[model samples]
Target: VASWAMISNFIDVVKEGRGTFSIQGLGDPSGRGRMISFVKAPARGGDKEAKKPAIIAGTKTDLRRLSMGKAEAILKTLGVPAEEIKLLTRWNRINLIQRLSTAAAADGSKLGDRYGGFA
Candidate 1:
């Protein structure tokens, strides 16, 4: 929930026009698994009130690993400009366990920062 909140807030900031976007998530596990969400930012006040689809993707059922490729795909699907989307991951208890179990456990690439900008 924390990571998703951060991502959603970030997306809201970069989407440009206010009150022009809607955000949603798919594959979210409610209370059990990881939370994933999509941010849809479209131009406002069109000829008609066109509804845009909300793109969705999320972590696997285990909630320990998140695929950057999948995350990128979801952002693309939601029409997020490539240069304006940032990715942030926060580890919960399950993630810590998974990281410790791996023999090659010293990789700190994904742990680079708590906040980053895709721009």
Candidate 2:
């Protein structure tokens, strides 16, 4: 399957919860069969009633691979509001950078150019 298609499937799994699914016609030129299993992380603190916000974050290459339009569309199909999608994307990017910075500091290694000079 195309990279974008795989990404879309993953996003769907994240938004709609885990289940067994199939992605046929992938990994072969002849369009053979393929099955995929999606297992979501268990709820933290064993609080089944707890709610978690779904936020998508990725590296620059990942972001480039999955365009904002496609990402927004995927989220919209899952019932996310357009305005919240914008805010979520922005917040996720910022949080990603902050986490990277924190990890770099803890490890005593510079983030370097991999993060677009975010070090």
Candidate 3:
């Protein structure tokens, strides 16, 4: 979807634009990965069933410089629901990102329990 591409492009831009600097001033809230990524559950018993969906890391940091208008336009093109985009483009989208990451973690955790953990 366009939304996924938007994220991917943002990542590429960050990596291409000398994004090699990180600071501890962000503290424990910035632990581990600097960006969000998805990981799927392992296959069920000899690959009979399809792999589970992936979850995104909530604590990701987007280093790309995106304006509100660009973000709105991008989300509109991506077909994201109006309400969801409203949250996503709001003053920083902290609430939505937090909720998304938490949901992803919870979903991944459930999948892990069901599938006996990821590789």
Q: Give the root-mean-square deviation of each candidate in angstroms.
A: 23.9, 20.6, 23.6
Please, what are the lDDT tens digits per residue for candidate 1 over residues 1-119? 47786466556656643432244333334544455334344455345866654322222233324465555443444345656444334333223323332312243333222111111
User: How would you encode candidate 2's per-residue C-alpha lDDT over 19-74 as one tens digit per residue?
Assistant: 32343333223454433433223335346785644333433333334456665654
Candidate number that wins on lDDT, 1 or 3: 3
Of 1 and 2, the candidate ahead on lDDT is 2
Candidate 1's C-alpha runs over 4 A off are 1-64, 86-119
| TM-score for each predicted model, relative to the true structure | 0.20, 0.23, 0.24
Clashing pairs in 3: none
lDDT of 3 by residue, 19-97 (tens): 2222223322346656443221123434677775443332133413445665555445434566777765454543443
Q: How much lDDT does each candidate structure score?
A: 0.40, 0.48, 0.43
Ranking by lDDT: 2, 3, 1
